[model samples]
Target: MTDIGIVGAGAAAAAATYVIDGALPDASITVFEKSGGLCGRAATRRRGDVTYDYGANYLKDDDDRVVDLVSTFDDGLVEVAGDIHVFDRSGTVSEGRDADERKWTYRTGLTRLAKHLFGATDATVHRRTRVERIARSDGAWTLTDDDGGTRGPFDVLLLNPPAPQTATLLETADWDAAARDDLLAATRDVDYRTVWTAVLGYPFELDRPYYALVNTDKEHDVGWVAREECKPGHVPDGESVLVVQANHEWSVERYDADPARNVADLADHAAALLDDERLADPAWTDHQGWRYALPESGLRRGARTPAEDAGCYVLGDWVAGEARLHAAVRNGLDTGERIVHAR
Candidate 1:
């Protein structure tokens, strides 16, 4: 049986896991995730009875394969039906950028996308298991966790971390120096944009024609403000939840600042943009800081050459050169197929 080891249980990793498991049913696939959650930045959270996707608002219906995958497996799938308004740096809101196609989400949130893909496979996923060291011996790969525990000489190893983090691993890995240098250099060339998000909950309803407000000019401190109430089961009746994401500049500036202050500032920006004073102070708030949230550029062509030669593969949205969730899934699918064919 083929033995596969993967690090970081993101969307691409989950997609790869599903495809690999299906192709080789008897294969033993093991996954290590540093965090307790799956799907990486396509994150979700629950506060009492409320559930919201604070990271990625919704998946676009642009890709047929992703659309088919979600529709086929996610029974709780729900489409977001309202238009998205544009908010400028001047705090003016206008409606002209409504999406042509539907925005899809689920009752349980975006994390369900990963869960569905992984649930179908027999792969064993270990959460909160941080793999700190990577080593190779006799043409086989092994991983060492933070607790000094080692994972194994597997036939194949897949890396699903962001480009920068993946570069760090390659730098410290006890593998071929020339191959590692090539991969690390290529990975270092991949750029990323950070994002700081704030989730605000209000007891009263927000009477807005649009479900979200995005900054078209890219000059605003607040990049996006989306309403969770637009999703079917995200918010309760008569209550509204707004997810406010700061722009790249704002996020980088205050990434190391206090959480409470950042949340308040985002709420203030939202209040001015939405023309509602009530949004300035939410009843309750949740916050997340994504240091390497979105990839600005894709990996270089030669980057994967070295890894592939070493019986190692790296796949993610960044590798696919797109920050979208669909791209990550597609990358994983293609990577899985490549691994299967190579075997």
Candidate 2:
């Protein structure tokens, strides 16, 4: 039995495993996650009666692969076709017919999609287990956790961690010095930006439309605003929920700042956008900082292989050109297919 080890239980890892399970039905798979939960960047938080998508809010179904994968999950996903308001830096709003472009979201929460991918299988998932190092010995690979203990003799290993972190992991592996340098150079040239997501719940409703894509090049810090209540199954009746995404530059600047203050500032800025004073005070608020929210530069596809020469592969949105959940899932599926076929 070939043992395939996958890192990061996010959409990419889950999707990859889902694809691999179909291709290689008897192959053993294991997923390692630094957090207790499976969702990597697709995390969600429930505040009161409202469930907020703290990570990826919505997915654009522009590619056929994404649409096909979404169709597999019947009740797990819902399509939204409504008025989408796009605001430029000058505060000028534009509403177009493209608003009908399909936007898919999880019914209960984004994490539901992850759980669905981890369906009945012998795949071992180690949560809250941080991989300290990945090395090779006697033609087999070994993965070590923070405690210096190792899990090894794997047939394949997948490095799905963030790009920056992937470089570090390769350094600790037994790759040729030249290969290590090349991997470092590849990752060093790659850049990533941060984003601060502020999830707020208000007692009163804001007059703004359900989905507002804002491009404020001035004092405002938010780039996109999604009214959580507008999405089905997210909010209860009469309750208002909002998700504000801060611009990359602004999020990076205040990445380590106070969470409460970040949430308050986001709420205040959103209120200014709607010119409504009621939004100035929200009933419940939470903030999450994502240091690697989006990839700054595109990575060369097929440029990377397993650093330890093991069947382990690397997959994620960062390698797939976009940071959206759909892209992550597609990337995972593609990676899994490639691995299974190669075997």
lDDT for model 2, on a 0 to 1 scale?
A: 0.76
Q: Which candidate leads the pack in lDDT?
A: 1
Model 1, range 197-269, lDDT digits (tens) per residue? Answer: 9999999999999989989998999999999999999899999999999999999999999999999999998
All candidates: CA RMSD (Å): 1.1, 2.2
The lDDT per prediction is 0.91, 0.76
lDDT (Cα, tens digit) per residue for candidate 2, span 1-343: 7788877798888888888887788888888898987768888877666777878877777779867876777576876536667666655656633665777677777887878778745678989999988876665678888888788667888888888888788877765555456656776567887889988788765555546555645345788777887778778877788788888878988889888888898888778766677787988888888888877665564456634344556678887878778888888888888888778
lDDT of 2 at 170: 80
Candidate 1 runs further than 4 Å off: none
Predicted model with the maximum TM-score = 1
